[model samples]
Target: MAILPRSQRLALAAQASARPVSVPAPITGWNARDALDEMPATDAVLLDNWYPDYSGCAVRNGFVLYSTGVDSSPVRTLAEYNAGATRRFLAAAGGKFYDISIAGAAGAPLASGFASDAWQTVPFLSRLYFCNGIDTVQVFNGSSFASASFTGASSLAFIGCIQYQNRLFFWLPNATGFYYAPLNSISGALAFFDLAAFAPHGGNLTAAVTFSHDGGNGVVDFVAFILSSGDCLIYSGNDPSNVNAWSLVGIYRISPPVSPRAVCQYGAEAFITTYDDHIPLQQQLVALKLGQLPPRSKVSTAVQNAVRANLTGFGWQALYYPRGRRLIFNIPNADGTFSQHVQNTALQTQPWCRFTNMNAYCWGLFRDNLYFGAAGGVVYQADSGNLDNIGPVAADARQAWNTFTDPMRKRITAVRPMIQAVSGETVSFGLGFDYGDINIALSPTTAGAGSPWDISPWDTSPWSPDAIVDPRWRVGGGTGQSIGVRMTASANAPTVWLRTDFRFEQGAAL
Candidate 1:
């Protein structure tokens, strides 16, 4: 008689596949097929959207001011007024900007000569700059609200504005160029300088952001511009006026059909969401760090199919919160809700999570807090409480690990799941043998107090080891060449799939 191995260990690693159609065979090392409706990190809770229907958001003086969406009958806007004795919140609606400082406070037209109610506001240089992409830029200083005047040009309209290197840069949609005001100057009398002539490539300038870092010579200033044609241009220099001094450092190409507002800078890296032209409607979330080739990894593939099915044109938004080390993309769904794909860059273990039930239109990071505005003049802070949406919503985290197969045919007797979970948390397991020919449900396992944090006596708490739960069923005398397991958790508890141990009887080759 020859002795045979009694058990085998199968590790769950890299659960990147989320689409059921793309689920890989368990024999491969690919860990999961889906992790939606849950957080990206291992054993973390899924948080819901905080507020209701706010369409726009901006952070000022430690408060998140939200504005109503344009879909409503009368558009509403929110702006902070801190000029002189007027320290209040202003509301703009019904084709007019009003001073809604106090409840019942008589509404008055915005003194800034804002002719239209549609405006996107951003705070920079001690003032709030407002633009509707068509009208002249409006600024609300601490003292007064007024329209900005540019030298040589009677009226200046820009799609977006960003403050970098003490200078105000605006994206010129009409001329496919970029114009900037003097360094640290926000006065209406300053002349706007054009950088289009100096730019290397010719294309519609969709977005621009500055990146500063200490280099060989000293602090090097670089501005990255994204073109409508999916080309990225980088210019290096400290001064924008000295056109000759600013040299083109690098250029990279990305998939076109991307949103102009979906680009964000994280450290020295820029993350953008775009669709692959080669693949029909295949969306990808890519990252490009300064001085490096574009990364080939599509971090958003976990929900790529779902996003492509629901995303509308190039209207999505991307935001990065440094404190949480999170990169969030808000993609509009056809159902009027929004699908927020959150990536935890902080934890390299598990980096993707898809969140739903929230319809955030805009996001703002204020004082290390993440704030978002939804559709109906509502705003909420993220990571504030455990509850998701508005009520106690249960988490729906699920994963299907790779299949386990023996070199020769075998009879699977039982499976022992080694899971680390919070006390009282239950994890359900589904077993499929012989490439899913025979499917069976294993007895659910409830984890014990597996960590010191789960028990009392905080300082003196002992670390409890993990408990391996063995299924009682013998697979109904199931015989197969391979086996796979799928696990799911709906409770708001932390869970981590360490590995699964399989006990089987060896048999002759088929």
Candidate 2:
């Protein structure tokens, strides 16, 4: 009886198709199945003309702006705005404050009281509240504008604003605190009646927002404060009037070097990009859910080094699209453009993807539509159509499998890749042997046209299911002690890799 060589078992565990700073060992099952340069998904088309130096973005009262002028622009502008009574899309631009809701008419300058380029707007009680920490908060009740008597700290500027629980909250950065005004207050006072004291951090207030989570018993609302020193304080309970009613549910820390404005709530968690203490010198994209404590796991490790190398600075912006369950982070890239790190939470297993071309500076979701303002004054509707910025869609994924080691030399007989290609799409495969020293391409497969219901041919075959495909490709002859595989797809067509199988036979050891 002859002794036989031992067979080995190995597989690539499911992981985000991330581009790591350095590739892991061939045995580490977490290597990305896609390349770093290839976008995680298809590219989106540009929806409007360029609006140079696009700055802030917001969606309210059923209007979306393709671009808003930066602070320095002569008319800190918006393409359109709606006053309550008008059905016309008003073009508002010019002066410190402008109203643009009149049809076919140039926007008129708003009240001159507002400070130049320092406004943050929020919608509540059928009115749009515009606040600049340097001036009194302004309100537009659809048809007209008025100023509210803000009875906060004297000269306390309102840097940010949000609406929660039928109340309007404003971030008083100058005071290093926040104050709220009840929407139904009888006195019509916009006063800092309730102060959100952050005594623990000693006041480095940067940004604040509200989020809600399912806290076992029921849904609970929490206010999150982001400080310049990287500490995040989350408080529970709706009313800030009663100090005891608010409880500190969690105190988490993010990278100290982060833009104060770079936080957004998605589902029950908030996502931010900042330096990771564990991996010094690298910025990590992290997620913090309610009740999840510090030492948060880094979700962007696969691309941490890439992110650190490409970031122009700490300026970042983030937003969540609930309809798509996607969390998008926009960071200025080294080349002046922006890199959008998109995370699809619904796909838990493979959640991260990168997008470019839009170079979005900010994002807003209005009326269930996603809009982003990019450089050169361009605005885009994400995932709107096939083309990207009116150009060809460039999409690809590079997958590397774990090394298949054998006690003796092995001759690879067959390689079978299970892939699902969208109809009218084609996907290509590539193979690498001996730690990818040698690479070869396999036969490309073009998916067949799926069954059509419009055709009148009664004698028709059953619809071709996506799962049924002949992925087996013969690799005539090759002997290797260890083998690996790399697969790629480059086209507008979408493809998904289900799995891959290999067959080999024992041979003489090298």
Candidate 3:
């Protein structure tokens, strides 16, 4: 076989490591990674359009904005033809116009005057559910329409809302009253959270009510709300327990067009986005310091062993990890202060995945990846690993070293030495070196192969060349003081150091 040179070999190895590992897209596993490659840019959907339906409108930005019309006409039965009506707005967003049904199937055209907003897919149910007007709730079973009618909602007027806990929750404008219609049981279960007393004249609550993890803190749990005034309110989720009195830790009031809807945490920073603001101008997504938690340490070594983990804050409302992705966080604008340079690259990807160019939006997270609702009811997902913890590894020449062969002379690639441990004892150890390995001799005298020593089963004498040996094994208990030997290398290989700990179990008595 023709062998590649060391230089060429190393370069090939590095390049191979750089390419992202691809996984199949949800459902089809169709490797849609390149689906949007040749997609016509003219067909792409913009951020300004409204999508009303369950899994209603998907956007490339990793969010699906479903609208639940506040009110609906009871008498109109949408025939098959009208059920899938295609409408072209005065402003064209270039994508092919397709009927928005429950799932490209049978459903009455949306009840007249019914508007949809931020309706998310329900787990285990194929239907997309949302609140329409004040008194009515609607559902699309991927094929047909089902509705939950309300008696008092016909006249209840509200502005700006979100879906939570399998119910449509919204705040009435000017009245500041919170109402919810359960999609599962809408008739009698239709209830409204009496927020009228809390914010009379209706303190504009922009989005949905959400909770946070207290991590066992008993005093108070936090709930979040966005005011129509564009201010954020963080209050206690206390129900008169008095353990924690509802108080505002931070008040955020951004300018108009800067309507804040979602707030999430990333490490110690909180990122928030507005309803319709795009990239920079809308200040759509902003990062803020988490008042409850401390900043995460950069040093990986220190981070693993530190006593204080520094995790804090309440949970999120609108955005959540449905599938694939592990950790998702949002940052508020820095100190409620705006910066012109910072852009919310929240869901930017090269070779964007285009599904009919309608709209791409993220619904949930599973297995550390994001579950997205792309155009055509086709779903797409991306692993969160690629987005988080991205940076070049800092290189250092002086940190390199070797061991075993010649600490001061020979440069070693890798090395391992023998180790002998006694049973019933706990062993604590550490490795300190520059780069190369240091060999350590476990037992000085040992019976050669084929004798009782060989039959002992516990003996690893014959397999001495393997990882069984520690290059630098320092004896313990006597003059050695229970400390293992030191393995020093002339060069370091960005290695495994920084005070490691592990339990070593001995097989048999020496």
Candidate 4:
């Protein structure tokens, strides 16, 4: 693998007049989408769960993060084995905080803690709601917790439940229907909404619940839930008549080996996740993109069609979209490596993957690389050429002709000469800056044709004269700002003897 001289490569870039290549600015950002600042002390490690909150990144403080086991319990908090980290916290019955993070090993006590036995779930909010049993429900506020009493009625005990919009709902194991509360609304103090009329038969217990805004169009909102039997159900939020009712719009029966975990709705499409263990670990991606909801049906076939169409391929999983960037997907390979792909490109292609010993599970996008949390509390970053396709590359190409205001200073758009790799043995590029100045850099890659070699005429004119300057052009106006050379690629040409450099600048000046 011989390295090509930058001079020769410069010429090759311009051999063609019609086919021009424009480099893209790379995609760059931070790591860990759900990274928490001011993490708790190491000794006091607790179970962590990410919930959808309206306030962007402010789900903590106001909400309680709990731990299931105690460090003192030998069996529960053994020194080895992930520090006994399988903790689960949920809004449990009787407003008690269910500490499920501890390992219920032999000879280990439940671990002593404040209000552990007195409260079933911790009080993270002013009001608490949970299912006491099948056909029984309870609501407890500060008053209820103090008095050890509830004001709601008992309804069918739900096998599983979740709360949204301040109302809690549950499902019956049989899936025949759903029972909602407060079962007994005595006077006006307690409230109850009977959704028995809206329940769908054969609907198993829902394992997950999520909602999606209607893409900000005010068309309709969405409610999606996954059942234990691996079935998915979706409903439209536009039915003003049945505000609490959910119409079964559509269903997907994924059988034989895939367990769906997360569900997200984008626009009118629903993305479902399947657990995988392939080389790079496959995440079975299934989508449902919608066209229009059915007239009288609870579920919309339009939505189902959209999902099925998007899930047309296997071995694809859509990561949660990064806040500032477009949708970048992780395409997994057989060797535990993955590439990030941009859906916005016509070349909806995935990046190339090269294994680097351990797997690179992308936690976040940084500058031009993906950052991963390694096995032993160490962090690693990887560059898979994802940046070459976007970000800095594109910005670099655009900067050649457009005026780039120093991002740190005032809003001054400066343009310069477009760097064009010239013809000859020693090919060089002329960079015209928006300020009428010229600069150059060697192309590190390929060196092209046209063999005269000497391009001295192109180099000395650092800034072109005013008479020849295009009236539309303006003078570049800054010192710290880039007015000259940026980057260059070159190659060796035996016949011609010359070294060349290319430069980009704002536009011609005034």
Candidate 5:
């Protein structure tokens, strides 16, 4: 082969140039990695109020009027008691519990004078039992809210409780064992079961999570007692008081929970929110034995660096909303503010997302619907409509950098965020260069003046059906080796993101 001159080769390479490439929008959800610039193109660098979907990122549903003005203090907990066809929703705040079933100002305090704000509640035998580590175990029997009549445990102030094997079990703070009542008996003398002997790490029991496991031979229900030292004692039995009926499964040490409320049960599997990660208790055992990462570490691996400071923060809790198929983990800050790390479990990958402007202190379910207790004396029904209460939802997303493995710098010239909007919506377009957050201020969004550029022409498309795709090309300008497109919108009408086209020059030495 004949050798080409250096100038000729350079000229040929320059002439070939690089073409514009379009990439599907990120749907694998928010990735708060240490090196966000290195994340996959399908993962979001910063995503809020938008859920990851297989087709694209979709706007989240909003909250509506539930109840408010319970007290000046924060509404710490929301609970429900369902008996047959009737369901009653209750709100707790300022050391008092109120009946807030209807949408209005909370009714008078149903139960008052409690010391702690946190309460562990479980519904059993047509009534609900509560434990707060400071107050006597309170029982809400649909009408009355008062202390239980357990004869033997009158002096015990239980911190947490769960219904396992047909018994109401209670545990105290800084104690290795727990208290349980006889089977099928809600009001009776309680029996003490000591776990100090079986637990290996010898730490106090923090919480009990009840779930079922299927190991090829049908499903088996188990209650997992989580120790503060990360030791978990799982038991399978109906009667703990009977030596022959009760038995210990195994004691495995994993990441301890941030709080007693950090464990969330979705269907049959329970997810434990620990200092380092959110993983299933069953998978944690297998991962520990096989020396592999828990399959669901994706929940925390993406936000490990971001959540490291919040592992010990207050108001850390997880709740599963079956109506919306969302698994929400509440992360509170030192300033009394909070954000939610939510996952859409309906999706196969169970993609993650972050939610803002919805500062929920705790979550509860009533009539198979989701509701959350808020900071300023209120309870809002979440996943109800297109707007977050009254204000619009601020949907923001930052796509991973699109470098295409090129070492040379590039300049992004334009971006087209295919959005399906009702009527016409405005979306701000900003471009972040290099590897960090974008610095360019987005220009005002203007609707397309000309005919639509999609498959169907203007008149033929469904007129004002729900929403239609707007193919307006946004003019963007930035210079860097990597370019990440940031799309932001605050609208009452929810929208969908289809894909993005990054039109740019490949080699710009300047």
Candidate 6:
């Protein structure tokens, strides 16, 4: 039997009473809403702790202890400061902000004494600004951190802030209005851009973002305001102070945004994390009068139904990691656990996978690396290695069950998972027949030290006799017409899942 490796197509190797079915790693990614047999072969029924790469490739997501050992707590907000030639990363916990740019027992808090720790920060004009609508706004200019007190800044207590059209834009938390400072001025006089008169549904302002669009004329910047009732007010203009220049484009409604940071910049466009959908700003802007959704982006279609139930949960965020070509959507569970629905934006199909062991409360990018703030008052850098600082990275994937060749009861004789080798690493695997649950235990093997150059294998061996995975054919026990491959694996190095080979014997057709 010969197994051919194609893009995502299955290569069959038929032998006497044997069916060698090559199951490729699902680029169609995680599907929790669809039926077992109704999904494509490239879709996963259960995928966790696995980070999908460009192709149908995945590596066990790993993170080391970037910063920890302060008071045990949850790092709810991760903030970044961008200086012209350098960058600074900060974390918020226990009503204080710490300099997490360096990895260690987080040094003395950069700024403290806040009633609330959940802050929204943005870098503008070579400084980092912080706001939460509870306390006075603060600013950090690489060295000094203090309350921003300008001529008219004492009354500027907004929940969020962003730099749009060479100006500082802010939105009031419980008011259906927004305030904008003068062009390129972070201080001095502030102008109120009231949306309460424009909001048809009439709810408090939730967030504000600057959206860039082309309407057959040229590129223009539209100031977008999101309301608690899902009313979105889009306006086109650079200056809001000039009444004639600022015009209300339209007021459309969408799902209520999770937070002020629900919208993330994605290259020329942006993505909004709504309660029920991951809507693209450009595509949404191009829609009809009501800003209806267009053809599915398939970005979060598979798992959105499950995510809808947890819309009210805290710690929801959307981040676009340009360095990793990823769009990570952090989901908060009712049980306090967190999982990320990651989309590989590099791929045209935009395959998505669920990542376990990444209990991220907030996300930030600095120095072109991905970092997440989680519990324990710690911030960890992702994609660092194969092992997590919190614990071992346990990956589990259940392929879509399907009846191959003929619809007949068959016995799964044996199965072999073709995994890319990383010297000597342990791999625990098990099988699930029909829709049964699968449990795979850990049995680690000692790592192998590569042989020295020009060293003879017969004369010298790296270490002791190790019963490594070898990924040899293991005995599989399953008796059903539809079969699925269940694997749980982890390593300290990059791991690629090519495909799984199945050997089966057909029995009664009925």
Top-TM-score structure, candidate number: 5
Candidate 4 per-residue C-alpha lDDT over 323-416 given as tens digits, one digit per residue, 9 for 90 to 100: 4223333333444444333222111221111112223232332232333322222223332221221221111111122223332222223222
The segments of candidate 5 whose C-alpha lies over 4 angstroms from its true place after superposition are 1-18, 299-313, 405-409, 440-466, 508-510
True-structure Cα RMSD, model 5: 5.1
Model 5 agreement with the true structure over 127-183: per-residue lDDT tens digits: 998888999989999888978888776466898989887788998889999899888
Give per-residue CA lDDT, model 3, range 1-510, as digits (tens): 999999999866644443121111111111111222222211111111111111111111222222222122111111111123331110001111123223223233333344433332232133344432343345544444456345555344344444443445555544444555555443444455544344423365555444433337543334455555554444543322233733544444432222222344442233343332211211221233322322221111221221123212111122434331212222222222111111212332211111122222223333333433333234333322211113211111111111222113211121222222111111222232332232333323111111222223335332222212122423322111011223221111111111211122111121
Q: What is the TM-score of each candidate against the true structure?
A: 0.65, 0.63, 0.33, 0.31, 0.89, 0.85
- Encode model 1's per-residue lDDT on 1-510: one tens digit a residue: 764444321211111211111221111111123242221212222222211111100000122233333223232244564444546554444454544444332344556344554455666766777766777877777545677765544457666777766777775455556677766777544445554554455567766666655657787767777676666677776466676866777666665435556667676656666653111111121234344444333333534554577645323667787776667777766666666666556544323455565555556554456655555444445654433544432333323323232356655555555554446666665666554532325667666533433333222322234322222332324565544455554443334444455556666777
Assess each prediction's global lDDT (C-alpha) against the native: 0.50, 0.47, 0.28, 0.28, 0.79, 0.72
Which is better, 2 or 6, measured by TM-score?
A: 6
Runs in model 4 lying further than 4 Å from the true structure:
1-163, 168-209, 212-219, 227-231, 236-246, 249-260, 265-270, 274-322, 328-373, 378-510
Per-residue CA lDDT of candidate 2, range 1-510, in tens? Answer: 864444321222111221112122111112233342222211111101111011100000112234343222332222223345532221122225443332222344455544534355666655676655666666666566677655644553676777766777777654556677755541244555322354345446666667666648887776766666666676776566766865777666665434444566665555556554121111121235443434422234534654576644522666677776666666666666665665545543323445556555556554455665444333445655444645534433333323243456665556665544446555555555554543436656554443422233312423234423444444524666645444444434333444455666666666
Q: Which stretches of candidate 2 lie over 4 Å from their true place?
A: 1-121, 130-140, 143-149, 173-175, 182-203, 213-217, 238-241, 244-257, 277-298, 302-315, 348-350, 404-426, 433-488, 493-510
Q: Which ten residues in a row have the lowest lDDT in candidate 2?
A: 51-60
> How does model 2 fare in lDDT?
0.47
What's the count of clashing pairs in each model shown?
A: 12, 16, 84, 83, 0, 1
Q: Put down candidate 6 lDDT per residue, 401-427, tens digits, no spaces.
A: 767756898888777766554566555
What's the CA error at residue 469 for candidate 3, in Å?
Answer: 29
Residue 8 in candidate 4 has what lDDT? 68
**Could you tell me the lDDT of residue 66 within candidate 4?**
19
* Model 1 C-alpha lDDT versus the unseen true structure: 0.50
Task: lDDT for model 6, please.
Answer: 0.72
Model 3 bad stretches (over 4 Å): 1-128, 132-136, 140-144, 154-168, 172-175, 180-185, 189-203, 213-221, 233-271, 274-510
